[model samples]
Target: MKNSKEWYKLDAFAKTYSSIISEGRTTCFRLSVLLSEEIDTDLLKKTALFLEQKYPFYNSELKKGIFWNYLQHKRNGFSVELENTYPCTDVKRENPLKIIYFRKKISLEIAHFLTDGIGASDFFIDLIEKYLEMKYFKREVNEREVGNNEETNNLKYKYEMEKSSKNEKISEYSDLYSKYMKRVNKEKTVKHAFHIPLKILEKGQYYVTTGEISIEDIKRESRKYNTTVGKYLLAVYFKILLDKYPQIKKQIVIGVPVDLRKIFSEKTYRNFFINITPSIDPSLGSYTLEEIIKYVNNYFKIKITKKEFYKSIYKAINPMRNIFIKSVPYLIKRIFFPFIFDYYGERGYTTGVSNLGILKLNRKYSKYIKGFRFLPPPSKRCKIKMGIISDESKVYLSFGNLTANHEIEKEYFTYLRRRGIKSKISTNY
Candidate 1:
């Protein structure tokens, strides 16, 4: 049977996130691969065409209706062009996702409403593999042997299931509320930590600086502190803030995005992550890097468990289930949703740090690739964001800034070097 044309409804997370999009916040996530040689533009274009057919859902464009915005399959074909503007620009009728070729780099920039990091990574790997096969071997890789061999390309929307027992839900809910109350009662105001000051860009420009470090050295340092790489880097971040702004007496909060796939075991390629803010207060006392790591480690142990994770999922979904909220019209919701988010969402965190984890590829394709780097979306409030990704031998830390200064990057890499981890810095200013 032939597939029929149909419109797909946006998930709860997508609906809430879409309202926050504006010229300032593009809500775009980028995944790019650096090849050993210059990219073949013609071949990349062909591969993109093949990919559009393979993953039809990605080819759809956003549409606004009476009730809400939905995705409608495009009648025309997709296009892959050279990158012309800054990362994470808004998607339109002609182009929903942009594929750009610049020298040896091929990047895929997708709207956050479409999918999360993991989902985008899956698609990106598949596209690279196909492109390589077409470029070198002059053939196609089998669908079954594609990236992860997971059925992430399916268009059918999948959501979290309320599989936990009633007792389990109640227990998790109570625990979550207890934690929330503790934070609220402990600190009355959301502490806005010090941000590195720089001359703001004109309109659509941003800055990107990258550092490559040895994974082995990072692991050794992390093991010495009895913590994971993510926590260790986060600790380093907190230390930098403390050194830069010595007068901040309150807590320093960092927004970390937690992947929900491990908790729900769901394979759908939509947004399925939550932000958890972990902080360390300077008022407590002067502390060393090890102490900061200890604080972060304990926080993760307490908040990252399966039970706590489910509590977050329910908290996000339960409001959407309310009959009253469902009855409200889209215009009213669109008008006020962003204000609610700004008051309760953006002000809580000093900055965002997302670790894309490790990258694995077939031996044949791995040798052709130089490395992988993930650049997070630019922000209006946070000003600077950090993204981490690693290959077999090295880890790449990319600091993306909306302002025009290298002070933060310089201090950060210098700190890593002082700790005996060598780093090489690159930039796109």
Candidate 2:
């Protein structure tokens, strides 16, 4: 059967990321998988092409529409490469999503325009499962005495076959949201924000640091704090920056991404999350870690609601639908979109906090895997951003730093260490 998932248009968040592609932003995010055994490149390559056909919705490239940018179905073959460069460093302007692999690691460095972490996690896990199955079966065959065995050949045929899926196609998920939620009328803008004053690293360089903490310990701590895991982590981030650099800015804004899929019960593979920046002021006076956690809990309780998400959807779509803005050509938009992106994006936030919840598998193959990591996109303004995800055992707290500031991560993990929630940390500085 032909793929029903046609690439027609770029979704809302896709358009935003696409416009800012030229402004020196990588705009790509990564979802990585670590396995117990080394990845077989040949088997993984076969698995990659097969999965691309099964999930043909992802076989897309960005192209120019008459007025705006659109996604076109790309038939130029899937890209699978060795992990040589920085993670999530792919330019998302015209490139399709890629699969990068090292010895025991496989990562999907995809554009935010392609899909959010939750949506793409399905594909990532499936590819790993399939690759592992194929590798083990081949090993079994090579060890056998027979040259042309019927039973072995039958299993080989099954693995080689490309099966088309009637269900789970991307076309089933609609991009339109006006039918479900009402739009918010207006909201104020942040004129000024606090950016970390750390000296930045040079071009093509990124600092990677990860901490492995027990899920039970972190959950216990969050419970102790009377908050959720995400809010608790956000509070810890706020407290770290405050403790380190308290005298600098009046306001410290942190952008928290709210997954809207759970809100409307829609499972669109495109980007559907909204950012709600919850901030604290140093000018009001210095505050303790507990105070910041309570403030974050209270702020999210009030601001991150179903209704608030709907308003965010409205604000995101309105400018694109504007009569005047719509009339402008793509050339003008290419030049002007960065300002809009910066104003509403990294410019207003001290840093970002995103916890991608848990790492769940469709199949019960967790034994063969080690863990997972969700790497967020980094920008010049938000020099160091955090991405977190967990499994049954431990929570992986990953911070991708673009500056020379090593103390931020040190202080963050050190605090967790003192709280009786010890974190096994690693870095690529």
Candidate 3:
């Protein structure tokens, strides 16, 4: 196959995010696979090289242009390397994405500009499938299931862009803008939510702690609460926060990223998700777990409707559509956008929780795979974030923290244990 020298423009979401990224502060997401055995560096390298040929988009490098940043196909071949530092600390023009393997773990760290978790997971699954085949069977996996060429590879992007651009309704846009304005007008100026007090670590340093619990037990608890797993978990997160910081009597808002692939029919490996922040105000009164679950369930029901979801998307994209905003020079937009994001964007939400849903693998490859963990990007304001991934039997809750405190994590596991769920903890310090 010949390499095409084609450049793809960043989508609206990516375009907005690319401007705000700085050194040590990035919009990178990590999807890691923990193998049952030690990694074969040579074989893993060969696997990455082969997969890069199949998905050339992963091989693209970021470039700064007159109007916006774009991705151009990398002329030189791609290679996998050993991981040296924490996740997503060095995403820039030199290397926007990377594949790193350390001992039993193989991680794919991609800049958020490239794709969302759904898209990245698709690519990672194919890479793992191909790797297993090459390692054990010594054969090439069939491409018919995935696609033939690069164009077919990015079909999701093509479909989503086409659909998003075509369905422009002025009324819908106005309604979304109105809602955003109403929220901002009455938005309370609250201090950053209390985090477990600990000595701050050096820049780019992160502490990762993971807890494994039985999926069956999680389901049982969720059923008892009459809510979905995601909501139940969010309730638990809020409960722990309240326990740790009882003195603060303000609302605690947690950002939950909803995957748009299910709602929108697009299958693109690019980003297509929106964040919804569900909040609980302790000033109202002490909230029982039942009340928190009820609030979370109602929030999800209202916000996840197609009309509401589309409104949120339009709200996000509406700024880019303005003629005046679009007319601003790139340099000014670069400086102004990050400030807007820092003050209005990051401050609104206390923390973020992303549930990647369950991972399905063929039985043959399942034995070689132990499980999966997701590491969220580091944030200065929101010091701790939670990422959830599950296999058939066990659910993995990973906490990616910028602070050195273990108090919050300790309370979380203890709460779970009190509910008759035992947890096994592991950490990368």
Whichever of 1 and 3 has more TM-score, that candidate is 3
Best by TM-score: 2
Ranking by TM-score: 2, 3, 1
Put down candidate 3 lDDT per residue, 167-258, tens digits, no spaces: 52321111222223221222233335443445557877878999988999988999998887777888999988876666776568888889
Model 1 reaches what TM-score against the true structure?
Answer: 0.85
Candidate 3 residues lying further than 4 Å off, grouped into runs, are 1-4, 140-199
**TM-score of decoy 3:** 0.86
Error of 2 at 13 (Å): 1.7
lDDT of 1 by residue, 99-192 (tens): 8778898988888777778778878888898899888887854553232233432322121112112342332111222222211112223546
Candidate 1 local lDDT, residue 422: 92
lDDT for model 1: 0.72
Q: Per-residue lDDT for 1-429 in model 2, tens only?
A: 232334556667777788787423777778888888988888877776666545555767788876788776565546888888777655655565888898898888888777777777767777777777777645322322221354653443333232212332333334644334355675454647888888877776777899988988988999987998877888899999888876875588887788887876666666677888788888777888789988888888888787777777777777777899888888888898888888776788888877888877744577778888888887878888999988888899999988877889999999988998898888776
